[model samples]
Target: MAGKLGRTGRWAWGGLLVVPLAVVGFAVAKPVKVLPRLGPAPIFRLVDADGRAVTHEQMRGRPVLYSFFTTSADDRVGSVMTRHLLALQDRWSRGSPDAASPTPLLVTITLDPERDTPARLKAWAERVGVDPQRWLLLTGAGLAVKLVVGTGFGVYYETPPGNYDSRYVLVDAAGEIRAVYRGPQLDVATVAADLALLQREAAARGAARLAYAAAHWFACYPVR
Candidate 1:
């Protein structure tokens, strides 16, 4: 009777181990949805630094890092943030030769449209060493779009007369607004890590889609 009890205890312990292993295996096999396949991205019809009309549809395929700020209120911190973003763009652009696609797009939309004119944006770009082809400084006609986009991305700004603050928004490749980096004090390392995660997520999704297509094709022609 004692021998029989020992054998049963051993089987129970083995069963416990096997159950968790099976659960882990099943979880590993499950597919993960990288980026929310959120319906079409929000539309924006803003004027670029060159005074040309640019739309959200035109920027679909590439990831966009958007920084929204006012030039009039605390240009020093805003300019510093812009320099960091430009540095990031330079780093990524340098890796383009090895990458499947070129550098990601950067757009700086001004909340203080009244002051941030095309000429001012051009000067700011030159001061920060921003590439014209990769970085765009956008300004819109009315305050309504600014409020709408800002609120949607959780960017809080109180532009009462004679006082202002800063807010930055980062949009991913799928055009989905992924993060809102607030305040004038921006951490460069944190921003870089977020951008890296976005790139990895996008690449993983692309790879999964390609694999799915290949599997579907093979199913139609088995033993090929």
Candidate 2:
């Protein structure tokens, strides 16, 4: 009887471990999809590389592609990511003569305020080929606020004294959080494609507004 009890106990312990492992495996295998939509995006204020205060409210009426980063030891991925962002900004800002309206706005917010000063951010921007008119790099005061915003956007960052991970977040014009890319998981081609979608959306919104205005004006004049 004692021998039978020992065997049963072993099986019970093994089942306990296997169940949680299966659940975790299934969760990892599931795919994540981020839908593109317009809504009131979360609000935050930070000082830009030019020492100017920038807020989400100021970015309203325009599509915003927001990227969040920290200047910690794990910032090696940031240079490459920034390059991709700058390329998209250049492409969108130069209005296609064949196309109507301007492209979306690009905003980069630094998570490490203690280390990423205005001078440092400006130098980084130059290194990453950021255009002053199109791309704005910002930094904030405390980690608490940054963490709260980052969490709200589904961006994760870890700093183990000397090590860190870079994360990026993309927000749309209607103030809605759209996409989040972490570390080296993102590529230049993907970033460009995402920006193109945003540009098209912005153009459509602009056209709708112009049409409404024209209709109102024509109604008032009643052309003979």
Candidate 3:
């Protein structure tokens, strides 16, 4: 009788072990969305619409949603991108006031600096109904702008011979490039979701920080 009881206990333990192993196998096989750590954000000097000097160093310790545009035309290139970005700002601000640190800044860097002077940027800001307190439009020397946008951000754009990639780059508070969105993938909900996730990860500490890092390592972004 004692031998039979011991045998039953061993079988029960073995079954429990199989359950955990199966779960681990299933998790390993499951598809997970992961954001690639593109690289460090480029540091550069630029002037905001308010004529304030904003530098890459100043942008550190806060998440920034950055987009490039030229007020040269109201085409899909510039106008469409601005509309989508503004929508993201609205949704994010309304979702939770605490969802972002540094108050969730939206930076619009002008590719056409010669035409996008501070005065021009101020005028454009007025036309677009931008709340300068939240949204910032920046312009600087041609070479500096080109280096920051093209070489630093990995965005392709050229002057005189016009070519541009309409995209948005999300930089985390730690100044790391986390994700890029463009085309049909650009949407307020998606941007907002990513922002919230990154903010939570940024604010985490101790074991929580470890968990967030693990999620990044495992590429745990949600499927769109």
Candidate 4:
């Protein structure tokens, strides 16, 4: 009788362990949850390096990655980030021949208008090897640009003297601000993963949003 009882106890214990594991495995298998939307992107019109007018309307229906920088010699983060943004496209957007679509466009706006006119931006673009087709270098009325970056995009910056924060803003296809990265916190892998998640969410027709909300409710963020 004792031997039979021991076997029964062992089976009970195994069932207890397996039940929790199965629950965890089910949670892990759920669809990826995305970051919550930050806010609506601000409206603005600016000129690109090629002297063409660029507006928020034109950018609609496409995801955009934004960064504010100056042509000033001290702002090295701009160049470093430019390299990272380009790599983001090369690594993730350019998938196989059957890739669905290219990655989001990277928009770099100059905080210094006096020094970063369209002509100057064009020169800087060439010097930095920026592909005009993929990356846009924009400069316009200092106040308008400042308003768009500061008030519209919610990025902090000061004009005239041209001082600004080094940060990146990721906006979804619907012109909603989604993710923001700053300073050393920027991670290429994280950004790429988030962008892919956003794309999937946009395509999910409302089902993914509910799943994401459930994940958030359960505090199901991935462990580092």
Model 3 C-alpha lDDT per residue in residues 1-224, reported as the tens digit of each score: 99999999999999999988865764565333345577998998999987889998877777788988787764457878878876766765565546445567788899889989999999988987787866789999999999999999888887832668878898887788988887423777777667767766767789777655656666666666
Task: Give the per-residue lDDT of model 4 (tens digit) for 8-51.
Answer: 99999999999788668758775566666778888889999888
Candidate 3's C-alpha runs over 4 A off are: 1-34, 95-102
Top candidate, metric TM-score: 3
For each candidate, C-alpha RMSD in Å? 9.9, 18.8, 4.2, 6.7
lDDT of 1 by residue, 22-130 (tens): 5565345533323223244468787877788888877777777777665553567676777677676777666642276435788777777777777887777777687
Sorted by TM-score (best first), the order is: 3, 4, 1, 2
lDDT for each residue of candidate 2 in 92-205, tens digit (9 for 90 to 100) = 666632255345677777667778888888887777677878888888776643554555554555542233445566666567765566754556566555655555445545
TM-score of 4: 0.76
| TM, every model | 0.67, 0.61, 0.81, 0.76
Query: In model 4, which regions exceed 4 Å deviation?
Result: 1-31, 96-98, 206-224
List where candidate 2 sits over 4 angstroms from the true fold.
1-35, 38-40, 71-74, 93-98, 159-166, 182-189, 195-224
Query: What residue pairs clash in candidate 3, if any at all?
Result: 33-221, 34-219
**Model 1 regions lying over 4 Å from their true place:** 1-41, 96-98, 160-165, 205-224
Candidate 3 local Cα displacement, residue 7, angstroms: 14
Q: Over the full model, what C-alpha lDDT does candidate 3 score relative to the true structure?
A: 0.78
Give lDDT: candidate 1, residue 118: 78
Evaluate all candidate structures by whole-model CA lDDT and list the values in order.
0.64, 0.62, 0.78, 0.75
| Candidate number that wins on lDDT, 3 or 4 | 3
